[model samples]
Every structure is written in C-alpha cells, then in structure tokens.
Target chain A: MATFSFAVMAVLPLFLMIFIGYFLRVFHVFKESFFNEVTRFCFKVAMPCLIFKNIYSSNLDVGSYVPLVVFGITGIISLAVIGCLFIPLTVKDQKKKGVMVQNLFRANFFFFGIPMITNIFGEEHIGPAVMMVAFVVPIFNILGAVVLAFFQEHEGKKRVDFKDILHNIFTNPIIIGAIIAFLFVLLKIPLFDFVVDVIGDIADVTTTIALISLGGTFKFQSAKHNMPYIIRGVLDKLFLVPAIMLTIAVILGFRGPELAICLALFGAPGAVASFVMAKEAGADGELAGQLIVFTTAFAFVSLVFFIFILRSLGFI
Target chain B: MASSFSFAFGAVLPIFMLVGLGYILRRLGYFPEAFVTLINKFCFEVALPALVFYNIYTSNTTIGQNSGLLIFGALAICGIAAVSLLILPKLVKESPRRAVLAQNMFRSNFILFGIPMAANMYGNDGVGPASILLAISAILYNILGTAIMAYYQEKQRSGKKSVHIVPLLKSIFKNHIIIGAALALVLLSLQIQLPNFLDRTVSDVAKVATPMGLMAVGAHFNFARAKADFRYLMIGLSGKLLIAPAIVMIIAIFCGFRGPLLGALLGMTASPGSITSYVVATSMDADGDLAGELVVFGTALSAFTMFGFIFLLRSLGFL
Candidate 1:
C-alpha cells in the first residue's frame, strides 16, 4: 500500500502538469507560438542546464560500481542496436523508424527516472541513480543524433551526412551540458551555491514545462492513426525492455536501490528530446509525441508494479 | 560619505557591467542574433516567470500589508501610461513610432533592474514589495502597451482608425509573464508550497532572469539606429530615465514611501524601457528599430540616472 501510494505520489504531479498544459491549450491560455517558443527554449537552454546540473551534483564513484555501470551501458547499447534492427521490420515509414528505434532505448531518465528514484530511495541514495544518468545521457544523445540523421527522410535519395551527424552529436545542448558537468565533477570545480540553486530551479521545471508543451502540441488526430505504433512503443518501453533488463540485473545479483535505479533506466517513458530530435530531423515527430504521451501516461502503472515486486522480494 | 557613494556604486555597477558585457559579447559575435532572441524568449517565458513566482511564493510579508505598495505601483503605471498615451502620438506624428515612444516612456525595465536594485538596497526583505510592484507593473505595462501598440498597428495596417478590442485583449491575456505573475500571486495568497525539488528548480531558473534579460537587452542594442533616432532617442531617454522617474519618486515620497519602498518605486520608474516593449513593437509591425533604440538608450543612460536617484534618495534618508 505504501509503495503503491508512493508511486501515485511520484507520478501524479507529472500527469497533472501535462494535463494543465493540455487544458491551457484547449482554453487558449497559451498559443501555438508560445508552445513552440517554449519548446525551443526547453530544448536549447533548460534541458542543457538540467543535464549539466544533474551530473555535476552527483558524486561519481565509478570505481565502486563498475559492474552496475557496465551492465547499465551494455543494456542501453544492446537495446539501441536491437531497436535499430527490429524497428525497420515493423515500422514501414522511414522517418518513424528512427524515432521508434531511438525512443525504444532513450527513456526519460532525467525527468521521470531521477524524480522517481529520489522519491523511493530518498535523496541521499541518489548517487548511483545520478551516476547512471552520467553514463546514459551522453549515450542517448550520441545514439539519438546518429540514428535520426541516418534515417532522415529526403524526397530524392541522398547519402547520410556523417559530418552532420557528428556536428549534431557535438552541438547537442544536452550532450554538451553532460560533458561540461562531467568535467566540473572531475576537476572538482566548486559552483557557487546560488549558481547551483539557480540551475536547480531551471532544471526543476524542465519536466513540467516540457510535458505541458508536449500536451499543448499533442494531436489527437495523429493518435488515431498511430495508435498501433503508440501502444507497441509504450509496451516495449515500459514492459518488454524493463522485463529483460531487470531480469538480467537480478540474475547478476543486483538488488535494492541499484535494481530500482536500473529499473528506472529501462522503464521510464521516452525522453522528451526524442520528440524534439524527431521534429528537427524531419522524422516522424507525431509518432514520437504519441509515444511520449502514452508512455508517460501509463508509466505510473509499470513503476508501481515494479516497485511492489522489488519490495515484496525484499530487494528495495 | 565616501562609503555611501561606494555603496551606491556597488549597488549599481554590476548591473551596468553585465549590460556592458552583453553589448561587448554581441559586438564580438559571441552571442549570435538568434541566440539573443532565444535568451530573451527564455527570459520572458521561463526565467522571468520563475523569478516572479519564486519571489512571491517565498516572501514572508502578507499581501494585506503590501496593499499600499501595490496600489502605489498600479497608480504610478496607469498615470504614466495615461500621460504617455495622451501626449506622445501628437509629438511623434507617426503612429507606429508614437506607439513605440509611448511604450518606452511608460514601461520600465523592472524585472531586470527594479528587483535587483531593491535587493541591493534591502536584501531579501525588500524583494517582496519590489516583486509585488513588479507583478502589478508588468501586467499594467503589457495591457496598456498591447492596447496602444495594437491600436496604432491596426490603424496602420487597415488604414482605418478603429481599435479592435478583442484581439488586443487576446494578446494581453496570452502574455506568459502576466500569467506567471497571476499564478504566483494566487499560489502566494493560498499559502501553497511547491514541493521542495520543484521550488529549488524554480528559484534556480529564476536566478537567470535578470542577467539573461540584461544581456539580451544589450545584444539587441543597435548603435547605427541609435544614431539615426538620436532626437527621438533623447526624448525616450529623458522621459524614461529622468522625467517619468522623477514624477513617480516625488509621488511615492509624498505618499510616505521611504527606504526600500521608495527605492523599489524609484527603480520601477527610473529603469530602462522593457525588452518586451521592443518585442511587442516588432510583433505588432511597429517601428522595431525605434523600439530597440529606445531600449538601448534607456538602458545605457539608466546607469547614471539610477545612481543619481539612489544617491539622492540615500542622501535624503529615504533609502
């Protein structure tokens, strides 16, 4: 009961904010221009600040958790590879394939993962969770950039621009944020308390505002056509991936907060960046949006079930 | 005496330097034109909202006690707006330029300058009153600025002399800054606490509003245009930095406002034209160059005017 309640407590605010966004859009409280401008702001500035702050604040004790780090990275890479191969078989649309493949691996770790972990395990135990973010965020960006660029649609056939891919990866604000944050941590450079506080404030709203923006731009018309893809994507992300990844982690003797963190990595909804990347790369942005909405909407159930099972097994 | 002068300098110089840094960065091609727009948009939609919300939410003072400040702020803004609307168009002769001039005259750079200046004078305790004033003033500025700009824009566009209230109201209501202020006020009044994580995140994001806004303002400065609009620019500068503030300060003082309250009011009246004025002017198809010029001149000259006001107020034992 406690775990269930915790799950609800964790996820309700996110959904509520998204709903407020949708409501505001319906009521014309915010215009399309407002959402577009805000989405760009989030993509460029807020998300980067969030990524940088998250990694910078985390204590990266890489040596102590080699196996967990190894398993986490291996899990993400394997999923990306499998997703790239498998998505083309199911999704006929060239643009959607990349978005599907990308989102299948890139969970909303920063937005959904970090908050849920903090809620369940307490903030003091968030070091491992933060460390997971340190590794996973860069991998997500690089993989996302490469995949989107590779599957970018063109009217006439043109080869993929490898230079564009590299540029995209390097110039990605979130990736840059992570790299800068990692350096800050490595160099032991102290950020002023106010600076961190300020970053935290910006980072704090990334999830809510991003969700709101997502809700504001959401198209129910597209959802009717994309229901199959949306359902499949949500199930794969929330259930299949976590089921496979957590089983492996458990078999490898992972348990408790570590297992929970790993579960979050595998189980959280698609990263909001997936939608942004899709839209920017001319991929199937609608599908990406649907996947984020559906996955985020139902992520609570998966989270509750996972937390309950882990707690019942006395692992968390 | 020297200490007070230095204190006044300490309060004002960092802000000036930041604006200068923004100008230099833009000149050196460090911050691209698009980057300036992005920074301003972020300031408008996210940072400024967060700043307002956080300040209002965390303030210890009740709204009841600060009703006086709120009333004084609303009246001051309405007074300025009324005066500007009644007189500026006749002087300027061109509708769009008049709209820009009137807006520049009435709308002070309160978010960037007012809050910080107040904080500099009286610390966090001062922020409550300053923030309340900011919220009221920002709403007024948007409503009045939007109406005036839209009216002139419609006149120019359709070659008709009628103001359309519906579209004007829509634009005013849709403003994110005003929405943010209204939300903050509601939450503050209800005594609702944002969760700790959310609170910290908001305050953190809010911290960027002032610096980013100042920087964006500096980046938007056009030196050539400033030269072109030299006469109009001087009118705007004198009105924004000198005349308008002097009037408001005298009124605030007569109303028994002293210390940080007077300082906050002075900051509101004396600061530069708001960046939003330029944004609205451009969006409304008004004279954006002139709007930008007014902002640049108002901001550039404000460092001296603000110093003068602060020093004078302090000398008079009002701050």
Candidate 2:
C-alpha cells in the first residue's frame, strides 16, 4: 500500500501541472502565441542547459555507466525496430504511420525523464538519470529523422539523404548539450564557478517549463477527429514498450536507479518533440500532437501502475 | 556567516549569469525578438502571481510576524519618491525626463524579483515576507508610477492629460499580479486551504517564477542601447541600484533587520529598473528614448551593483 501510494504521489503532481496549464489555456490566460514561443525557448535553450549541466557536474565513473549506456542504446534501438515492424499494422495514413512509429519508440525522456528521477529519488541521486540523456537523445533523434525521412517520400516529397540525417542528429540542441557535457567530463575541463551557476539557473527551470508549455499546446479539438489512431499510439507508447524493454531489463539483472531510469526512459509519455519533427518532416503533425497529449494525459496512470508493480516485485 | 564573501557571491552570480545567457543566446540568434515580449507576458500574467500566491499560502509564518516588512517597505518607497520629486525638477530640466527619472528612482522590478531573490537567498519557505511585500508594493508601484508620470505629463503638456482617481484605481485592481496577491491574502485571512491537487498545482507553477523571470529579463536586455543614452542611464542605475538601497539598508539595519528580511527588502529597493518604466513613460508622453535607455542600461549595469550590495550586506551580516 505504501509503495502504491508512493507511485501515485510520484507521478500525480507532474500531471497536475499539465492540467493547470490546460485550464489556464482554456480560460484564455495563455494565448496561441504563448504555446510556440515558450516551447521554442524551452527546447532550444533551457533543455540543453539542463542536460549539459547535469552531465558536466556528475562524476564520470565509467565503470558504473556500462549498464545504462549499453542497455539504454539497445533499448531504444529495439523499440525503434519494434515500432518499424508493427506500426503499419496499426496505422493507415502513411504520414501518421511514421508518427505512430515515432511515438512507439521515442519516450520524452528529455522532458519527463529528468523530472521523474528527481521526483522519485530526490535531485541529489539524479546524476545517473541525467547521464542517460547523453546516450538516449542521439538514438532518438537519428531514428526520428530516419523514420520520418522514409515515410515522407510516400507523399512524393524528396527523401532526406543520409548526410542530412547525420546533420540533423548532430545539430540537434539536446544532443549537442549531451555531447558538450561528455567533453567536459571526459576532458576534465573546469568551468568558472559563475558560469556553472548561470547554466544551473537555466537547468533548474527546464522541466517545469517544458511540462507547462506541453500543457499550453494541449488542444482537445485536434484529437476529436482521430481518437482511434490516438488510442493505439498511446497504448503502444505507454504500455507495450515498457512491457517489452523493462522485462528485458529485469532479465539482464538491472535494478534500483538503473531500473527506475529504464522505466522513466520507456514508460513516460510520447516525445513532445515528435510533433515538431513530424510537422517539419511532412508526417501527420496532428496525429503526432494527439499521441503526445493522450500519452502524456494517460502517462500518470501508466507510470503509477508500472512503478507499483515493479516495487512490489522488488525489481527497483 | 559561513564566508560572507561566498554567501553574497552565490546569491548574485546566477542572476547575472542568467541575464548574460539570455543576452548571448539572443546575440547568437537563438531567441527571436518576439520571445522576449511574449515570455514577459507569461511571467507577469501567469508565473509572477502564481509565485506570490504559492509562497504566501505555503508559509507557516503568519502575516503578523512580518507586518514590519509591510510598514518598512511602504515607508521606504514613499520616502524615496518624495525625495526624488523634491530634487529632480531642477536636476533633470525637462519635465518628461524628470518624471521618468522620478518614477525609476522609486520603483524597482520588485514583483518579479522579490520572491525569487528571497527564495534564492533563503529557500522557498522563507519567501513569506517577500510575498506580503509583493501584494502591498505591487499596488503602490502602480499608483505611484501613474501619479508621478501623470503629474509631470500634465505639468509639461499644459494640463492636457493628468491622473484620474477612478482610472487609477481600476488600473491597480485590474493588474493580474495584484489580483493574485489579493486573492491569496483573502484566503490567508479566512484560513482557507486549497484542495490538495489544486494546492500542488500552484506550487508547481510557482517553481517556474525565478528561472523564467530571470531568463525573460535577460532576453529583453539590450546591450547596444546602453551606449547612446549614457547620462540618464548613469543617474537611474546609480540611484536605484545603489543610493536608494544604500539609504534603506541603514534604516533596516538600525531597526535590526537581518537575513531574509534584508534580502526581501533589497529586492524591493535595489533591483534593476522595471521594464514597465518604458511603457509608463511613453504612455504619459514622456521621453521614450531616455526612459528606454535608462531601463535597458539599468538592467545591464545592475549585475555589478547587485553583486556589490549583496556582498556588502553579507559581509555586514545583514543578509
């Protein structure tokens, strides 16, 4: 009972934040322009600073990261492979098929992962979780680019070349944030105290802003026309991936923070960035957006159940 | 005083760094021009109020314990405005610019920075005094700001457009931050509590206040504008960030203020010029260029001044 309540406590407040944002938008307190501008600020600047600062400050301790790095990479790839294999069976629209595939694989670890780790174990124990971004973000972006690039050509659009895929993955802000932090850690580069504090300030604000902005962009009307597709995407993202990856994790003897991080990396909502990537890559942006909302809207229940089950089994 | 030097350094450094980060990101073309304006609206209309309400509601310290903050803050604001009005007419020469200077001297960006700085110095629960100060000072800022600008605008324009009591009251009551603070106070007085989920929601929203508030301030900072309007900029920066706070610090210390009380008071009197100064100035037919320049440059130079004052106060054990 205690563990179950802890699970509820862990995920409830974060989702309530989104609910606050939705009601604020409904009352017209947040206008249309707010959604895009704040979202842009969060992803482009604050999110990067968050990942960068965490990895930079963390002890490199490479002996410990073997599980997270190895499992994290394979976990994402397997989910992507699973997504590629199964999405066409579930979705009909070619553009939205890519979005669903993207949804099934990509967890918004960039947005939700850090906060969830912080929520469960407190901020001090979040280093291992933050380092997960260093490995996870690149795979998510590369796969996102490739999936969307291939599906986009069905609309008679020119396929994005392999070089462009490499370029996009390398140029992604969150990936760059991770890369730079890796350099700082590996190279033992010492930042001035003031510089660290400044970035820390930016890092501190990232998750809350990302969550609220995600809420501001929440539109019920967008989901009205595509409830069936949305439900399938949410189910695949919130349940199927976790049921698969987390099982593999337990089989491999993963437990504690690593296992908790895996749960966060797999079980949370679909990536918010998937919507933007879809819109830009000529996929069904509306479906992408809907998947994000419903998955995020439903993520609380899914997370509580997963966490409670894992805790009862003593897996994490 | 665990190294007062480091204490002050920790508090002031992040603020400048945030502003500098915004300035650099903007220079590199990451922040579009529109992001600054829109985010400012987000902070004021949404984040600032939520921060104040959350801080006051969650605080165990009741209003009676910090009642002196209300009295001290009000007196200091009114005192400085009186002084500025008495001395600035002969000093500034032009009626519009004088009014702008007068307004800048009395008003700091207290609503945005008050809780954040207090929280920064003394953690989240320590912001009770600051939130109480916010509710009172927010109303005072608007009333005084409008009265000062309107009085001089009338004087300069041969009595064309001066203040009206109804409009003034309406403007104060209409402001989102003031309304938020007022709501919190009403609930506080009645000993009402928000339902658990709603209470948590406000706490979550309030967490965004400092970082976003600082980022928005940083993004709006205009470095190039500093070079053109050197004179008014000097006066506004020196007066608001240094001299006014300096005078108020003596009074506070003499009255035995210390710790987070002093930090909240510093936020009230020593922060940068309010961005709204430009809006209020131009609306009253004042010199928009000088007002804009003062605000732009005041914010830029405030980093160094904030560091100095915080460092000094820390060394003195008044923070």
Per candidate, the number of residue pairs that clash is 7, 0
The CAPRI class of candidate 2 is acceptable
Return the top candidate by lDDT: 2
Report per-candidate DockQ.
Answer: 0.08, 0.44
Query: Could you give candidate 2's per-residue lDDT for residues B175-252 as a string of tens digits?
Result: 565577678878977999886656766766676766665555566566565565577777777888789999999999
User: Candidate 2: where is the Cα deviation over 4 Å?
Assistant: A1-5, A23-25, A87-96, A148-160, A222-225, A279-283, A311-316, B1-12, B58-73, B82-103, B107-162, B191-204, B213-218, B241-319
Model 2: colliding residue pairs: none
lDDT of each: 0.74, 0.75
- RMSD of every candidate to native, in Å, equals 6.5, 5.2
